[model samples]
Target: MKRTAAALAALSAIVLTSGLVPQAKAEEKKPYKIYLSNNFVGNDWRQQMLRIADTVVKKAPLAGRVDLKVENVETTTQAQINSLNNIIRTKPDAILIDVGSPTALNPTIEKACAAGILVITFDQVATADCAYKVESDWSMLPAVQAEWIAEKIGGKGKVFVDRGLAGAPISEQLQSGFEKVLKNYPGIEIVGYFNGNYALGPEQEGVASLLAAHPQVDAILTQGYGSGAIKALQDAGRPLVPVAGGGYNTASLVCAQTEGAQCILETNPAYLSAEALKLAVDILDGKEAKEKHVFVYGPFLSTDPQPSKLYPDVKMQKIEVGTNAFPDLAPGLSLPITPDWVEITPQEAAGS
Candidate 1:
């Protein structure tokens, strides 16, 4: 079985570049071909997802059992459709995709699955017929991270947000999460929310611009690339503002470890991917997979300096899971977690 799977992977890769054995003959083996369609490109988080996909492609214990192909095309609805159309043409045994929207991606996704292609989703997903999903509790965390920030700041101050892409679900969900928190504290005013577009240079520059615009910006809120925000804020010569955000990175963890920043709460999407892939393989092996979605529960919350500690639910004391995942305590910088705030710096978001 292992030999057959490996050969199939090699053969499938070859089939794409140069057709050998003819299409009819290639179909005879009915190989387990796997396609991974990643969402977004350029951001550290996106890169992390690709890194994990690469590791699985290279090192799955039954590597080559299926032909594994990967495509990362930034986060655009059209790109998603294009990948779907291409995968449909190939008619692979399975496709693992990171969705671009919860609602719009359904049509193409259903079309592929209706053609009998096995489908699974990671990162973000649509509401349609995904066989299963490997995702975190994204709908809840933005508020959780925000609530923490509000608590630390005593819920009374002006907060600026280095936001995410305008329409993406991550930006919306996390933004709402923070909004819910703000509702609890009427004293906290949102000064600005800039769509950072998940790029470090822009996110950082935006933070600098906001700092220049609002000298009294009490706290900065963001999701991904916040180092630039910190650099901008600190450069302006204000006392280091407390920051909070997410992503598992060495820089964020180092920030927490060094006590230079505030919070760096993050999720290990690799675990989510590993679990999701296991479900995909199980279906291939003719086992019962109970549901269409699976949620991985975790994120590193490194808060404050010496007072900061990992969440009680996830205590990784010696190894310290809360390391770079926090901002102010992240050895450097952080963000106030919000949904629409879709920028990040993933120095530690490892794939494998």
Candidate 2:
């Protein structure tokens, strides 16, 4: 028995010294490289979108599997084209784009596609035939709010129209939707039309200047910049009128506080970055999808339906405002729409 034990120990020693002992085989994971080509970072929504992408890429299952790089440039078509040209040369596995012009980037996008790189465009999308698009339905998003505004004013009142960036496809789509509804009500005079630029400060200033010139405004129709309009009205001591806007954190709270104020919050959530990233990852993983165009619809926030409230009888496309305006969330915080796979909380989004 002793000899057997000694021989076994000697064999073990020999195996260790000879490097015959098996070592753990480290996982050979090839990180999928992704590049984000953003046209602008001038607004809160755009910044939030980028942050969402960062968080999504760092989460489990994607943490070690993805290598993401983001590149931002001025909001010009030529700048974006130059950026795309430079990015294509790096030969990443996929490219996610937020463009300045719809058709300006088509040739470069086609070049990338031909080079075997997957190209996906989200908000501020391009008209590149070779690129996949992920975006919300712009027409439906504003039509519901426009209808609500018309309904609140009994189809006949002076209204102010706050537009987003001029020449932007989303801006044009939203305006078309709102105008289509407003056309049904000839009595609803459009008092003033100003470009809100989708930013709070610019919107506030523009609304304020318009208010100074036309103090008889009854309601405001806006694509974004709700909070700025709210403040402008408050500063002017004008009676709060029904306002409609794209999603704004501060606007949601302000609307909740105003006595006679009625507003609609239907925004394209910022987590769309995650959606774009998800598409890139899926494609890299060889997941097949039938359609290249992805459409996300906006959710209409119904108001608190209380008979005592000034705007209690309002409804948006049959979606009634629920019991709480901002349930389980603080005021002035943007809502984040995330799928289970992305795993992001609104608080995390807010903080970021």
Badly placed stretches (over 4 Å) of model 1 are: 1-31, 248-250, 257-260, 268-272, 305-352
Per-residue lDDT tens digits for candidate 1, residues 1-352, read: 4568889898888877686546665455344778888777666556555554445544444455556678777568888888788878988878888788887778888888899888888777777855577788776556556766787788799998756777888778777777877778999999888877766667777787877788697777777645556667667877666675555344355444544566545443543444555567679878887777776665445554222221334422221444324432323222212112122233332321
TM-score versus the correct structure, for each prediction:
0.76, 0.84
**Candidate 2: segments with Cα more than 4 A from true spot:** 1-28, 304-333
What's each prediction's clash count? 52, 3
- Angstrom error of the Cα, residue 30, model 1: value is 7.7
Q: Tell me the whole-model lDDT of each prediction, alpha carbons only.
A: 0.64, 0.77
Model 2 weakest lDDT span, ten residues long: 304-313
Q: What TM-score should be assigned to candidate 2?
A: 0.84
lDDT of 2 by residue, 221-291 (tens): 88884768878999999988878876655666666666666777776878778888888888888999668
Residue pairs in collision within model 2: 102-127, 302-321, 303-321
